[model samples]
Target: MTELPGTYESYWMETGTGPAYPALEGETEVDVAVVGAGVAGICAAWELARAGRRVALVEADRVAAGVTGYTTAKLSAQHGPLYAKLRGSLGAEGARRYARSQQEAVDHVGRVAAELGIDCELERVPAHVYAESADAVDRLREEAEAAREAGLAASFVRETGLPFPVAGAVRVEDQAQFHPRKYLLGLVADLVARGGAVYERTRIVSLHEGEPCRLTAEDGAVVVARDVVVATHYPVFDRALLFSRLEPHRELVVAAVLPAARDPRGMYLTPERNTRSVRTAPYGGDERLLVVTGEKFRPGEGGPGGVGERYERLAAWTLEHFPDARITHRWAAQDNASTDGVPFVGRFHPGSRHVYVATGFGGWGMSNGVMAGRLLGDLITGGESPWASLYDPRRLHAHEVPSLLKAQGAVLKHFAGDRLRPSHADDVAEIAPGTGALVRVGGRRCAVYRDEDGGTHAVSARCTHLGCLVRFNDAERAWECPCHGSRFAVDGSVLQGPAVHPLEPRTLPDEGPSGKEGSV
Candidate 1:
């Protein structure tokens, strides 16, 4: 079945047949409540259930349908020159703790995949961060040293199997990759079999923080639990003003059909160039597919050549390197980065006893997500985890202040700039079919999309989250806020959000286009 043309459709979601889960209908209670059904929530549910605790896993959509489903799924600790940067701020031991936690998560996933008899294409491959430029080679050398100090099996390898040449690379041994959705779905099944409950189409509208936090759903169902884990990719709460501290970046992913003989034998990423991440997934029984993802930008911003241009760039890159490769499927993913360059994984803040959150995994959600599971699971079970304080949401770093201030300034600029001048076009027919544009009607800005059937969808251009005007993200055919990472469908439905409310609907002008015939 073909998905909507411009909407975000992940290859993993289409290919994997995940298990069916029920929706919460009435009042429910559990020892621990998980607020999202991605890997982090899956891990928390699985861990708590395995430890003889009642877990009610609630998802706004189907299981593994969130960010974890769309990930490139590299289970490597070498997240693009991260340790060297962390060592400066988190100190040697703190950085080592971070690396150790990620390594443990990788090891756990591999072990669990085998334990559950899951055939998720799990492969143990050495991961490499390669550099093509001389200066980049120097940086790679320093990163190698940092990786070793942080307890990774790392070395600087001058020779790599990349189809293209590289000056040098940091090779970390025994890192793994797998079909993330399949692996997590296997865990989800195991959780259900072990007497855990999972609910889909259960959107948490609000959470009352107290003894046994109460989560009120959009449909008016309530779940009261001793502990609540908020593992939604971007934290749902804006109380901390995280919109300024955490920045969102969107990247294009393209997977090309390739012959089975073309195995790169490792997961590879380049930090110097346009930041390409490369790996392969098993296609049929005998064939393999190569995946490359890069070209980062803000959510609402599309390339000049159009929304489809980003896919073309990746296709061009693939044919250049591997001439026999054929373009197949492609999509986009939104990743959030903490200003301080680490994740916020423990309690929502130091003062909170029952509420916890896992967010800002940056682009490396796989390992960090699993680590968040283990960390949060331990905290809920009252176990002393060594990495707890390092990931505390309330932990303040002096370095992140400037970044937060700069991000807020950008938000203010976009908010003010969007309202400076309203576009004069009012007719719905002015918008071409299969495209969307922002225009003013009745002196109010509204986002308008014209479908191939000549139907128009119009909604308030102002984002519901913080009043920042959203822009038309042509690539995804959705409304994306540049300020705080909230997103909505063209029809005003909330997609991703710190915003619980949808965009306000607006009626368009009746007159189509103003075209007229001239009488001579």
Candidate 2:
């Protein structure tokens, strides 16, 4: 096995410990309840509180500690090769709305950071989507034109700050990047100061939508509000059948330290090599942190060596491109892609009156998340937003049918086909230490992980969100459901959701020579 560099953690998370809020202790009432304290939830809560609405922000974990913490933090509207595709699917006006919303999101982040005096390392930089092959240059040019038509200052150029040459690129100015955690934590502090409530480690188990929506926490605490925003990344409460419309993808991020002189000076992305995105952040006095992200795949779909191989590939690519880089931090981030090109950012379902959701940001959540905050706030406050119709969760275009069908097809295969597939190990003895595998114990399927200390933990193989079997992700050391992107720790605790419940605990038939008996 090839050794990969960097500590297995997010660079953002390692930097500082943001302020922590207490979990929901007992029942509470507010005007609105915002679930999941990522960028979307925090921004929404702050927006509502600033508008004199009583709001409560509830998070399953810490604020900005989920996908937001793991992101590359590029607050750019230059989503790779998207304007042209949007023009085709949504026509000219709809594409303009998207561009306008995204650009506003970029400016909103910088404006908020400055207004509130939040030192989040916000830096104004140009963003680029470059094409390496001649065949893709025309598409890049088309995207540049489409973006310009959509009211952006976009231009096609043959030059970039990248070390390697590119055939052509679509460059957009005045975009920015910042430390997501720092920015979010600042908003959270302001939200709290404004008399809005913030709760951490408060997992909402169920939501009862009504005259006053009631959200029940795992510990029996409740939050009553007139409106609810399900921003739990993948929407834990899937009353709208959003799982069918959203496809989950996981991407690997590798960061390394390089001399400040070697910084790329801007964010760059390419569609080639699965997908390559590059940006830099201030590290120390004379060094910058180069963050590279790529290798997008379904949650549990990495072939051969599994996610470990994916990380290796990204690391190798990084080293090849920047020889002076010294690996420092490595992690992964997951996002949901909507069937339609646009995100679903409005009502949770057609029947629900007060229940709303913000999800399916694809990989551009930094900007889309802020966009969701502003839009969701407008909807709850009964104010009109120009981009509301474009992001409506209930809107379904005819062009989305094919993508929806394909996404659902993959889910169906994993739900049924994985059941018939063979387990990773026939018996506990065959499993290795510090690894997990599916094993048949007493004729029942089980997810078993053997700790490095030679103790084994066992849980049912079935995912709580759906009946699909869970597969071990060796690289991340978790059980991931390929169907809907639910992740669980070795002890069966729900790590990422759509699944509010933990995996069912199971008992192993017997202990193997190298493993001691343990229970989840």
Candidate 3:
């Protein structure tokens, strides 16, 4: 398998590595304290600082080291398969509002990049969402119409620069793309220059809320602020039922050295369920990197081999299609998928107006992240933001029930099946070679696999997240959580999250020190 692209080498090397920003040292007061120093937090700090508001941004790790560092970084108003879904779920008015909000975000990014003179390779290019199957054409038409109604410059295209057979595609013109890390760093530098402080290595343990919100950091430092923005991908409040409202999906990405003949100009995406997207980044003069992403699945469930298979699949797909391209980088990023298929970007909980949260960006984090920051900044500064109502977190739309029920049903099936299934190891002698089976081990269920060469491996069937029983998803070849969509490899490695840690490898009686059990 190819080396994953998400490691420090693949990310920090491309963009110059950043130092760990200092943690919150002691009690400090600020106009706004932003949690999670990702694009959202950094952007929020930048906007707040520009407005002459004192801001403090805190990150558990280094800035942009979380999902933001792993993002594919496409800045486009054209979200995949979203317009039609939004129309159905949010109605015509809601759908239009959603589109407008996204467009406003794109424009905001452009304006910021221009004003800051940030050399993040900001370019206005069209984005295409193509349909792989013939049936998807109908959906594309519906999406194009919805986007137009939503006051977007969208149209349908029959042919694209992509080297695949597409039924039809929706194109959102003048959407933008950039180096997310560069853009973020530039904004962060500006914010710091303006007296806005960014504290890294500061893990927020808990939030003390009331008239004023105080965030207690792991180092025992407390931050007193008038308002707080929880942009930690998933809010850390009350273990967040918001996580249940949205499933976590893991997606693979391949950043390949582009061939001389191919210059990927516009952003491209497939409308298929687990489809791929292609875009290009100009490394320098006469040098470019092509990024391909897709192979999405819920965490801990894509079969026996964790996320390693996705890299292999993407490598093969890239080589077969773009043979001249050299596969230099590969990685995976986890995204929060909302049950209603829309992001929640507003006040946290009902009346907790002082605390705001931005979760469930789906796969469009680039656009939505910036949007959330601007919207939240406006909320804090008492400025008028047109996009606020569409992304309201408190509203519960009725249309999301069907999709939510489908995911919940899968979770229920896994929970039920895990209880009834027998361990595959107990009847190992009768099992066929080159296959895996569910088995009982010490009264608990486990996954036991026999290799083609007759080697055996065993792992626990319980998912790391919430302890929901995992089921083998044959299509993806991983153990999938029917509950929140965590996937693990047959060897018990993580394929996705909200399971941040990988599965614990089982110890074998015959193994030595190297073969001992392993955990996160």
Candidate 4:
């Protein structure tokens, strides 16, 4: 199935199916009411339920259908040159805390996966962070030292089995990967079997904070609970202005069938515009499929080639390097890039109790999601967790101010620029093919695209949700907002949101080159 809004048709979904959990219908009360039934929320529900606490897990959609379903699913303490940057900005103590917390999380997932007998194909693999440039080698060395100082098992490796060459790399041993959707669906089933309840298709519209927080769904159902965990990838509440604290980045992934000799033993990555990650998943008794993902860009930004192009490049790269490779499945995932370079997994706001938000996983959602669940669970259960200080959302770091400022500036620029002009609605011919242009129609600026086939599409320049001007993301072939990361298709269909409304379509005025026929 092609990629669709709110639906994740991943390779993991091919595994055995599970029972469905319906949405919240009427008033429900629980000891802990978790919002968003992705990994973080489900993990929280699992943990709390195991502790004999009444838990109600609520999801806006099906289980594991959000960011969790689309991840590369690597569980590791290595967070892609994160520790070295953290050491410089947040000091050695901060970096060490971050490493220890995530390491604990990796262990936690392994333990849970094993304990539940989940057939998610969990296994240990060494994660590599490599560099191709001389300067990048130096940075990689610094990061290796930082990782060691943080008590992580990391070292510089001069050799790897990768088909490509690299100057140097850092190996974080004991990392693991699994079928993400399989493990998540298993957890959901286990939670239900253990007498925990979850509500799918129940969107929480508002929350009333008090002794017992009251969560109201769009369908008028309410869940009053002693604790609330907001793990909706990007927090739904704008009260903390999380939109300003982080930026969104979109990454692409593709799976291909590989011969036995072509399979990789572990995960590998390089810090480049086009990164390559390699892992393998079992298809049957003797067949395995390779998973490859890369192509990173700031939200709505990428190379001249977009998601499809990147997928093709990865497939080609695999074939050139591993001769027996064959393409099969492909997809894209988007994650919030925290300004501080670490995930925020604590209180939702200053002086707020009984409310917690988890976000900013930075493409390492597998372990970070567990970290969030465990930490938030501990906090809600009135227990002390050593991981809290490292991920505290209230903690301020001055270094992140620059990234935040730049992101805020860009968003403001787009929002202001969106109101300046109207878009042209006439025809595809007005735009030169292969280029994105802005034009005015009805005194409103909109995005106009002319495809290579000479067909044209015109969409509302103003993003549906916040009125920010939507920019043409040449890479993904979609309309995106610099403000809140909403994505739409070229034909004015909603792809992702913050914006629920599709770009309004307009009819073009008929005109011709010779002034005798309709054009555009």
- Number of the top-ranking candidate, with TM-score as the measure: 2
Question: What count of clashes does model 3 give?
Answer: 30
Return the TM-score for candidate 4, rounded to 2 decimals: 0.87
Once all C-alphas are superposed, what RMSD does model 1 give against the true structure? Answer: 3.8
- Residue 96 Cα positional deviation in candidate 3, in Å, after optimal superposition: 2.0
Clash counts for all predictions: 0, 0, 30, 14
Question: lDDT per residue, candidate 1, 1-520, as tens digits?
Answer: 1232222467788788876788998999899999998888899889889888999999997899877778898998888888788888888998899989999999999888889998888888999998888778788888899999999999999888777888999999989998888888999999999999999988898988899899999999999998999888887876655666788888788777778888787899985446788999888876788888887777766657654676666667777888877766778877899889898888886568899898888899999988998898899888999999998888888988888888778788888876785652555567776677778777778788777766778888888888988877665778888887888988888888777788988876554344221110
The segments of candidate 4 whose C-alpha lies over 4 angstroms from its true place after superposition are 1-9, 302-306, 418-441, 445-461, 471-479, 488-520
Angstrom error of the Cα, residue 135, model 2: value is 1.6
Error of 2 at 20 (Å): 1.6
RMSD of each: 3.8, 1.0, 5.0, 4.5
Those runs of model 2 whose alpha carbons end farther than 4 Å from true positions after fitting are: none
In model 1, pairs of residues that clash are none
lDDT of 3 by residue, 333-400 (tens): 77887888888887888878698889889889988999888888888899998778777887776777
| Weakest lDDT window of 10 consecutive positions for candidate 4 | 511-520
lDDT of each: 0.82, 0.92, 0.75, 0.77
The prediction achieving the highest lDDT against the true structure is 2
TM-score of model 1 (CA atoms): 0.95
Q: Which lDDT tens digits does candidate 4 get at residues 249-290?
A: 877777767766665677888767477777777766556777
lDDT of 2 at 230: 91
Better candidate number, 1 or 2, judged by lDDT: 2
Q: Is candidate 1 or 4 superior in lDDT?
A: 1
